[model samples]
Target: MLSRRAALRFGAVAIGATAAAAGAAGCSSADDDRAAEPDPLLTALDAARRDADAAAAAAAVTPDRAGALAVIAAERTAHADALATEIARAAGEDPTLPSATTSAAATSAAPITPPTIDALRSMLAESQRGAAALARSLDGYRAGLTGSISAAVGAQQAVLLR
Candidate 1:
């Protein structure tokens, strides 16, 4: 009884309506599921990274101490990058930390003739505390990561102190 054109239009309309309904249902039930709260471990890691970055920037690295400075800076930067990625993945968002270039610039700048021991010590303490906090708060693989980082920071402290 319907014209050919009318039937084709009706079929297209039906398909469109079905698709829209399916999409709405899926979004309402599934896609809406998201993390209600940000992970505290992520927050701790981010804080530690920021402090490490600032400490590296403040420390006085002379020509003789370049090697130690580089090592310290590199480790902190690497941890930060890894943490940022993990945090973003957990939250389903892009990374929120400073980009690598800006972070590296602080370490690359000329330091005082001799290294600042006090500043380095402060930085190490901050890093260690951050790691410890994360270790205490998280478990499983996250606990391992924080515990390892805390130990590593302690070792770095020894190296700086020596």
Candidate 2:
């Protein structure tokens, strides 16, 4: 009774509506299981913190830029510490205990390269991407703490980029 295009569109909409109803009825998708796993977002933050530290160390800068980099690095380190503390708090562990596992990413002692503004630009770009990712991760973790961290990283990127 319907044209071919209209029939296809109707079928697509019907499928989508069915999927939406299933989702609203507490259906489980792969994405829904993300929160059940050990938080990958924490691992990502750990990696980003290391990268921020590396960037600060590698940046060839004047005194002003040096000061800014120092602040940025300190902020990043503080962010890592805060994340560790919050995670520990959630698990009823003493957050003060320095867990070696916190920084357990397998990274190399390789040197940072191309000591120039180009390098700085690259790091800034990377940091911005990390910030955006962290922001998106708010849904995967505790909204309060994760959102705060995302905002902090985003603000840091803005300052550093300027």
Candidate 3:
């Protein structure tokens, strides 16, 4: 006669085996479907570019804040470049080529109004939030890069801009 403990162990093992089989069978299609979804990093890259553009524009119109805005612009630009390189690498493309983000930004015809210091502050806060969230979802170097970017943006918003 089967013991209660032994039966429970057998059942658990059977269930686990069944689950593993199902997971393995589903993995290929899931991977293919996931490939169709856009990478979250692209959004982050675009935000960085926009923030850099905004900061540069703000600096141009608000001379008093140019010093701080220039720093923000340079940092954000660097962030954008890093993100673009990562995105390209992940896509198995040549990092030397201009990324979609860069091309789009360059061809963009929309005129941007120079923002006030308050507006720049708000934008930086938003960018920091997005970067922090993206950092949470990523791992490895991508995670560290975004985490660093978020921290820098936080400092910019809290200390530099203040």
Candidate 4:
């Protein structure tokens, strides 16, 4: 019994209502399911930080030998920061550290001698090897990462070898 104009208007109203309902439903589930997943870059950064902390602690007992280790620690910290930045960028979060807090604890320790240098060198060499291994592993696992991460890792290894 409806006239042609009324039928067309009814059809348009029905289509619009269906589309609005579909849009509302679509907007309700926009949260990414993968947002809760752990970030590999963050994990790598934490591991690097812990390794640097251990090295710094070992060197703390020897003031004379601490300089090289401190330098290495600084480098590791910088690398960690870089990794953190990458992770944050991927996550759409801020990358800056909360504070400039350091993990190097104070030690009333004595200076190590030439013999200690050999031990330090050996330890450093081992750490460099480990870092290189880690870099390779990361490269294999995360192909999407920027090249700078690998480059930083390579530079760290080179510095450790020196």
Candidate 5:
């Protein structure tokens, strides 16, 4: 009795649920009972950090705006360092810097014009949103973690948004 689109949507949802269940099961499989990898998340965070850094650098070229952007850059650097530490703890090794492809993807995207204070503020707002999302994604990895690392990281991210 369903329309064609409704049937298709239902089928897609069912397939997606099945796939998610399978993936969850696979994580518990005996053959490869290792923890889930955090490299992908780290890589994403690195790229985001790089983009934010680049934007901060560009903003710093103007003397009047340089001080504010320098603060933003320092905060972003701290965030990247925190993410790297978490990635290292999760992976049982130091986090490697992202590859050329990732660096390019992060920094070489299309340019935006921030010709005024309001425009620059808007750009920084967008960057903060992205950073917040990345932080949230990384927070999911702290389920069984000890101590207050996750909380600290979340606090730092909140400071960045401010």
Candidate 6:
């Protein structure tokens, strides 16, 4: 019973409504999902921080290796700072603030048991492997940063740890 003009108008309205609904439903879901996933760099950051803490603690426990441990601690701390900055930059957050990807509370909640010199060396080896693997999986500045860290950790493990 509808006229040709009415049919055309109805078709247009239906198409528009369907498009609007689709847009409303999934317009930002992809972005939200990406934001919800923890950044891989978080693992690297955590490893760096833990290594730094471990090295410092081990230095306190064993004075013989204090000088080498101090260097490792300083370098690992620098690596952590760089990784945190990168994470903040990627997330479009303020670099000074703790990244939303990793809450400050979560970081503090993890207990750090001081490791022996041998354990610290093992930890560095693990960190080097992880950083190298992550570097391979990523690209651009992130890959370079992680690769550089990996090389530094490798040097620490091979040269300083001996």
Query: Taking the tens digit of each residue's C-alpha lDDT, what string does model 3 give over 1-162?
Result: 999999999999999999999998899688778678887888888889889989999999888888989999999999999998888888767889987756877798366788888888999899999999999999999999999999999999987799
Best by TM-score: 3
Tell me which of candidates 1 and 2 scores higher on lDDT: 1
Stretches of candidate 4 off by over 4 Å are 1-31, 96-162
Candidates' lDDT values, in order? Answer: 0.67, 0.62, 0.88, 0.57, 0.53, 0.90
Q: Which consecutive 10 residues in model 6 have the weakest lDDT in total?
A: 100-109
**How well does each candidate superpose onto the true structure, as a TM-score?**
0.58, 0.55, 0.78, 0.49, 0.44, 0.76
Ranking by lDDT: 6, 3, 1, 2, 4, 5
Candidate 2 vs candidate 3, lDDT winner: 3
Encode model 4's per-residue lDDT on 15-132: one tens digit a residue: 9999999998776565355566675455556555655665576567767657766776676667666666666666666566432222221142234233244554554455445545
Model 2 lDDT, full chain set: 0.62
Query: Worst lDDT window (10 residues) for model 5?
Result: 143-152
lDDT of 2 by residue, 62-129 (tens): 45477767676677677677777766665556878755446453243355553444555565556556
Collision pairs in model 1: none
How does residue 19 of candidate 4 score in lDDT? 100
Q: For residues 92-132, write the lDDT of model 6, one tens digit per residue.
A: 79998876544772557454677988899999999999999
Runs with alpha carbons beyond 4 Å of true place in candidate 6: 1-29, 98-111
Error of 4 at 106 (Å): 16
Which stretches of candidate 5 lie above 4 Å from their native place?
1-40, 94-123, 134-162
Show model 2 residue runs off by greater than 4 Å: 1-36, 59-64, 103-141
- As a TM-score, model 6 comes out at 0.76
Which of candidates 1 and 5 is the stronger one according to lDDT?
1
Query: Which regions of candidate 3 are displaced past 4 Å?
Result: 1-31
